[model samples]
Target: MKNTLPIALSNRHVHLSEEHIKILFGEGHELNKTKDLSQPGQYACEEKIDVVGPKNTLKGVRVLGPARKNTQIEVSLADGFTLGVVPPVRDSGDLAGSPGAKLVGPKGEVQITEGIIAAARHIHMHTADAEDFGVNDKDRVKVRVGGERGLIFENVLVRVHPEYALEMHVDVDEGNAAGVKNGDMVELIK
Candidate 1:
């Protein structure tokens, strides 16, 4: 039997810190949960902000909640082109030398030193799921998708944690290239 996981297409979004949230939204303002994400405790916020790059400004970018330790901006490769930024492809939270941009909210705006990135494709597996697949944390694997645009994605990272649900996340560029959508099952190529 082949091990498979559901695919989730991630679009351009921003994760804000508590301080940044207060600065962007308002003092003591809280994010309103619009929808729950596949990952536990993650949700879409009702608020949206604008991302100003050197070349152009991306308006009304959705914000994800709850606030994180540091604000991170995840954008698709196409978004990078639109913003005139060459965001490095990095794993989420691994934004050391990536690009930065100005984030504008209703109340205020923030200039991030370095946080923008084109997130790498990865699978989020629970410990039990990892055991079932015989994979470990931070393992690199390949996934094969079936369809007219079927292709094998290489160097896909595997993230294992107790709280993580079994799902594969891909940026819009990858998803469009593979012709895959949310809820589509992709086989793990060991």
Candidate 2:
């Protein structure tokens, strides 16, 4: 079976905590869906905020919903430099000892002690898709993208879930370095 997945370029974004959402938006506020994301039941919300990093502030960062137990900020390496925080590359929901930032919203601001990160590249595969690829959850793999500017990405995490969509997620920097865009196919390198 062929082992390939479409790449999904992930830009700078924030996933708010339920407590923070109410503080930022208001009491009993909910995010509005701007568009559906590749992941099933996940959508881009209309809410946006500014994250104040150590050295600089980044504005217009979109917030994804629904809220989680804790808030997390995902940014590219370039963004980390702009904010002057060296974020560790980690999988989603793993924020131990990661960076933190100040988030400014319309209604209020949140000073987070930790939760910022440069998200590690990963592939979201359905259970059947993982079987086809011969991979398991938490496994690290390599991905090859070919073109005028080809690149091989290592340490790509494989996340397999029944509800996952078959897509590789990379930040803007990684996508630009490979000269790949959203919907570009990448072959798995065992």
The TM-scores of all predictions, comma-separated, are 0.98, 0.98
RMSD in Å for all candidates: 0.8, 0.7
lDDT of each: 0.94, 0.93
Which lDDT tens digits does candidate 1 get at residues 70-143?
Answer: 89999998999999899999999998989899999999999998999999999999999999999999999999
**Candidate 2, clashing residue pairs?**
none
lDDT of 1: 0.94
Model 1 compared with the native: what TM-score?
Answer: 0.98
Which run of 10 residues does model 2 get worst, by summed lDDT?
A: 1-10
Q: Which stretches of candidate 2 lie over 4 Å from their true place?
A: none
